[model samples]
Target: MFRTALRTVLAHKARLLMTVLAVMLGVAFVSGTLVFTDTLGNAFNKQSAKSYKDVAVSVTTYYSDDDGADGKKQEPGLSPKVLDEIGAVDGVASVTPRVDGFAGVADPDGKLIGNGWSNTGTNFAPGENGKDPAYDFTEGTGPTEAGQVALDKDTASRGEYKVGGPVRVATNGPVKEYTLSGIFTTEDGAVNAGGSLVLFEPSVAQKLFLKPGYFQMANVTATPGASDTKIRGEIESLVPRDAEVQTGKQLADQQAADIERELSGINQMLLAFAAIALFVGIFLISNTFTMLVAQRTKELALLRAVGASRRQVKRSVMAEALIVGLVASTIGFVLGVGLAVGLRSAMGQFGAKVPAGPLMITPVAVAAAFGVGVVITLIAAWLPARRAAKIPPVAAMSSVHAVATMKSLVLRNSIGAVLTLIGAAGIIAGASMGKDGKFSIGAGAFFSLVGIIVLIPLLSRPIIALVQPLLNRLYGVAGKLAGQNAVRNPRRTGATASALAIGLTLVTGLTTVGVTLGTAIDKATTDNIKADYMITMAGGVGGLDESAVKALEKAPGVSAVSPQRASYLVIDGKDSSASAVTPGDIEQLLTLKTETGSLDSLSGDAIAV
Candidate 1:
């Protein structure tokens, strides 16, 4: 049986190649999406482990409300008192209150520099050596004074800043001169999320950050063998309800989950395209099987005449399909792994942190790929295989075109005309519906489309019918042959048209929806952002001091500007954000749909209407 299957596939090299290509593409897509998701998950896990050491509890201030008019609670800076409260909790060993601020690091020459990018001053606990795990000291020592700084090895290497070298740094504050004390690298040092760290003592950090009595975050370390559950409860009791408390492991898991949810839709879209490719492959295989059976008609009859049961003959053809499916799947799986690796490398260049883990080929992925191959093969070969088994010895010598007589135009007319009319009605009705009616009305429209797809075989006869008269008038030899080709196999013509129609349906739907959605977002952005131009502080999502806003106001735009204050806004368990602006600036940039009060008159009231 194995030799017979091999011979059969080898006999038709072109058909086998086409089938393998299609299966390879589908498997590659599945492999890429799975690997991409796994990569992100592993990267986050490894990064979190290397960046933080045993951080059991953290409490940080966040915005309580979203009223942009009030700037009171907008800028979320952790106060030192909050740190003291957390440290006072039972089971707490020591509290290291850190004031983190990001600034672009320039070499002494001040040409190329590091962009100051930080994670909005999220807290990290002290490591085993009473230092933050995020920054590794490679040069002189950690920051001990206001003007001294520590630099990551990557940033220091890139800019040629070495130990004891005087480096000038620019931030919202004065352009301070600091000696590069040390260079360090984290375990996952591919990216410096905390930016080029010019760390300072807590007092210096407070002064540089422009927070008089506040700290950005505090890293809490519990006593050895302390119960985290009890420590968490005691910490929560000290901090306000609005403050965020999360363990290191919990944050890492949440980050991974967040990335997965974002990529879920993208994977679905890729799967849809892969399915289309597989669908097309099914047609090609079916055509190949049909031709093979047609040529083997006499051979099948001989087998039957030689006392071979119909069941035995059917099994042989099916066993051949099984063999092809298995071999193709194995080859496709190997190709898919290579494709996934290429895709991951390309994405990495664009700064996507893929998880560094071996490709996890789950049993489900293997099962799905093999199952798809088997199912497509079985369905494609079913009709031809059945016909081969049913061929009688006397009918073995029938003419090649004998099957054509059994198909007629009468049956097509009865079903074709009705479906065409119904499809036309659906398209018309669907087009008539307004925006509000589109959802409900579109369902009926989709049903109509289904009808059109089903009746393409019948409806296509009309196109053939039209082509015949035109062809008969247009040419003598070619036209007659073309007309005969169209009219001879109504089912085959319809099947081909239906397949094309499915592909176009997906294409047209996606294009239309993409354009419509893009237009909608553009309109929304235009309507909401009423400013002629925006003048933001140097750091908007990151903390920006007043000096940065002053520089923006001096820019050539020469327009009035607004200062923005933002904080983490956890509304109903979803992390949305809120920004604070002056009431007058809010009136200019944002079009307020007020429920109670005017935007111009917003004052001490918590609710901005």
Candidate 2:
């Protein structure tokens, strides 16, 4: 049976190849997307894991009340008592604490450098934090005193500093001098990238930052042989309400989960695209199967007449489909791995860090691809199978290319058309109800697209008739034959057109949405930004102070300078930012358009106007 199937496929080698390629492409897309998803997910996990190693808990403090109830102007970090309590736990191994402070370091000659910090008062200190207190110096010893500092490799190398070299260090309070004592690097090298280093003692950082008794984190390491789960449970129970405890693995998982959640919508869109490709492939497969079965109907009928039962005939055809599907799916899976690599690389260009590795192809993926291929084949071969099974030997012997004549259903067809029209009318009526009802532009557009797809077949005859004259004029013989060919099998023609139209409709609708949204935003921004010269800060909101505005006014390009203040406000639990301009002479500076009243008469209540 397998040999027979192979022979049959070989006989129509070209057609078989085309069908197989179609199936392969669809399967490849599915495989590639799956691989990309897993690869990116793992990469993110690895990066996050490197950052949060051996850290059992973290605390981030923010103002939680309406009033400044606490007289302590600067909020205290995790107290020394909290650290001691965590360290005193039976399962706890050690506690390392470090104060958070901002400081600046300069080279031996006191040259201000971008790599190191300057004039920032550090306020935090580390006391018995479980993190390794000893520094892994790249060149010299850890900080010995307040005036002694250690620089990371980046700062040390960039500044041409060595051990015992004089490096000017300053905090927010005043400039302080320090000698370079030692340099070190973190395990992941992030410390160096951040252009900072640690002072071994809490007092040193406190002096540099101009604040005392404050720390960012109390990194707690588990005792040897301690299970992370147990440690996490113990730590969570003891940690303050504002603090959060998570195992290293849990933190990595959380990061991956967050990224996955963020990209879920994008993945859904990609899957939809893959499904569309599969759909396109299904049509091609169906066309091939229809042609194949039509060509071989006589052979099938003759076999049936001799000895073959309906069951045998059905099994034989399905077996052939399975063989074809297997071959196509295998080829597709291999190609898909390659496609995944390319997709990963493309995403990397867009700033995703996907490392090279074996693709995470699971059994489920293979099963899914094979299943889809088989299902598509069966659907494609369905009509042909029915026709082959029903044809009598005499009828089959009459003509090899025989097509079943669809019995005329003028009334039934008319009824279907009427029903479709009714459905469309209902949609239109619902849309007319507006905001009071559930109708929307999106719903209307969706229904319109679907209605067009459904009614295109009924409408195709007329549409083609209108185009036939033009086609006839363009190509004398081929055009006439094409017109006849299209109308000869209305159902087949309609099916083909419908399949192609799906892709076209998607493209058209997406284009319309893109254009409409783009135009709306562009028009809105253009109308809002009526400034001749908008002087703004270099980065982020609340940029460019009043002093900067004054300086800009002193510049030669000084025209009328309008300072706009933009600030975010939360109203009714929704956040909105308002860009406020000083209300000046409304008539001189700008002309405003109003739907209800003149801008000259507008009050503060109509500021959004």
Candidate 3:
């Protein structure tokens, strides 16, 4: 049976090729996502470990209710005074206070040289050994004066900034010019995640980059022979209540875990697309197998007459699917590795600083790719295989039958109509249920699509008949013959057209929803906002400081400016956001349509809602 199945597969290679391609595409997506995530996660893990190599313990400020306007929790800076206490702890070898902030330098063409993923900043103090463990200078020395700055080697080369050359650096404070004192390389020697780093004197960094009297974090090294656990304990005892102390390994592990969590979300998103592709492939596989079984009707009946059991016939069909799936999955896995590398390069261009690392393909990824492909193909072919086994031996001598009976057609159309009504009702119910109705809507859509596909044989005849005249007029003999042939085998024509129609339906539905949603947003924005212009930071990290607001207000030709701060909050067990605006400017900057209360009633301590 297996040999016969293999021969059949080999003989129908051209027909089976389409099935192979469909499985390959889906398996490629699954394998590519797994490889990409594994590679990226490994790189981030290495970076996290290297980042904390020198620090035995870290002391940082903790935030409780510090969710910022952008819905992200803001890391509050620790008071520099806490550094003295941490340094005085027993087992603490050395304490280095670090001040970190975003800083960008322009290239010769005035293009910003850093990306959102890149961390560009200056360290406030060198390590106890009089060297910064994070950086090593490739040329000249670290910055020693307020007017001098040291840039990472990559940034220097990319921006065409040489030693002693004047460079402009932009920070939250203001843009300042400094002499390029040195070009340095970080511990990993790659732009920290595609970001740039600039070093400056402690005083200069504190004054120009960081908030006054605040440090981002303090790195504490343990004394020689001191355990990090003991050092962490000692620091924790001395550190202020607002600050949290963690061992270096704990910090590194936490960073790695965070990156993995984020990557997991991306992995799921990619796998969703893979699932859709595979779902569509199921129809193609089932349809192709059905057609193959029909073509081999006589051959299957003859085998049964020759004493082959029904089980053997079914097994043969399954064996054919198994071979196709195995071969296609193996090829897909290899193509997926290349796809992963391509995706990495594309991500890099978009400023995802994935560290250079070898592509990682795990055993689980390979197993999953093959397992999913084989399982899906076997499941899709199961019904068709059963039909092949049920073929009567007496029918082998009779003529082939291709048309459906009137009774079967009526029954199919009735079932399809009922299913379509049920599906439509479910869709309406799901839509009315709001955000929690995703599953309902998805189920509804599935049923609706299946129902529509089932009814296609009945629907296609009329649709084809209506278009037959046009097709005939357009192409004469070829068009008329094509139309007649299409209406002849309703099942085959319906199956082929349903596959394409399903994909188009989904695409059109999504596009319609997207356009409608976009238009609604535009209308809302125009109706709500009364401001002439709004200034926003490119990255929604830190908002514009008061100085920036004042500067904007003082700009010539600017009539008025308002600073609005928004923050995320848990309201009535639901995640929501609130915004703060100046009371006086609220009416001027916004068109508030009050139902019960006037906008003028809003005060510093009172909220409209």
Deviating ranges (above 4 Å) for candidate 3? 63-85, 88-90, 109-111, 115-120, 187-191, 208-214, 401-414, 427-446, 475-481, 565-588, 594-609
RMSD of each: 6.3, 7.0, 4.6
TM-score, every prediction: 0.74, 0.73, 0.87
Q: What is the lDDT of residue 192 in candidate 1?
A: 36
Total clashes in model 1, counting residue pairs 3 or more apart in sequence or in different chains: 6
**TM-score (C-alpha, index-matched) for candidate 2:** 0.73
Q: Candidate 2 or 3, higher TM-score? A: 3
Per-residue lDDT over 357-384 for candidate 3, one digit per residue giving the tens place of the 0 to 100 score: 7889999999999998888889888977
Ranking by lDDT: 3, 1, 2
Better of 2 and 3 by lDDT: 3
Clashes of each: 6, 22, 2
Better of 1 and 3 by lDDT: 3
Best model per TM-score? 3
Tens digits of per-residue lDDT for model 2, 178-208: 7776776543322422344545346766433
